[model samples]
Target: AAARNQEKRMVADVKRKEQAVAERILENDEYAQVQEEIERQHRAYEKKFQDSLGRHASEERNRQILITKTTDKVDLIDTTGRGVRPFEPSQVTTIRDHSFGLGHNPRKSGKLLDDVIDMVRDKPE
Candidate 1:
């Protein structure tokens, strides 16, 4: 009877060891799965960020090209206008130079002339 009791205890001990080993293996597998999931998410985020960067670069290139084309078109228009109707430099008129001492000048002065010319030249008819 004592030998049978000893055998029972030994069996229980073995079973407990086996259960502990299995639990440990399961925990390790869960950890590996979690690691894999994190790696996959990181890869996806990196790919998305790269794709967005590529798209933005392409858009910037297109914008620069558009600006260049617009500048060339403006140059062509200015050249054509000058060819058709040339502009003579305005002669400085003898007037009371009020703007020499005062900060305020006539609105129809050289600065305003340049501003009007810039507006007319930049706008599309």
Candidate 2:
């Protein structure tokens, strides 16, 4: 009878240890996920900060820049004197045609669907 009781106690102890270990593993996994989320947010914020700084620098430099869109037509000037002249008509053979007047460059313009719809509706309907 004593031996049986001893075996019962040993089994109970093993089960308790197993439960504790499982709980610890779950907690560790949760902590890892939280840590990864924090790191991703940190990287996003860092990239945003860098982009803002670059824009600010460019804005500052653009103040005194001089640029001419049509070389023979007129001279364009910005603050930094680094303004670029628009290519002549003869040099504009690779012009992009936008279904909507969003602009030639889709990536740079980033016009949304809603904006395009609005523009179309605003046209002579």
- Model 1: per-residue lDDT, tens digit, 1-125? 99999999999999999999999999999999999999999999999878868977778767665444442222122434456565322212222333443555454456654443465577688
Question: Could you give candidate 2's per-residue lDDT for residues 9-35 as a string of tens digits?
Answer: 999999999999999999999999999
Off by over 4 Å in 2: 55-125
User: Highest TM-score among the candidates is held by which one?
Assistant: 2
- Span of 10 residues, lowest total lDDT, candidate 2: 64-73
lDDT of each: 0.61, 0.57
TM-score attained by model 1: 0.44
Segments of candidate 1 deviating more than 4 angstroms = 55-57, 60-125
Predicted structure 2: lDDT = 0.57
The 10 consecutive residues of candidate 1 with the worst lDDT sum are: 87-96
> For residue 85, what is the lDDT in candidate 1?
66
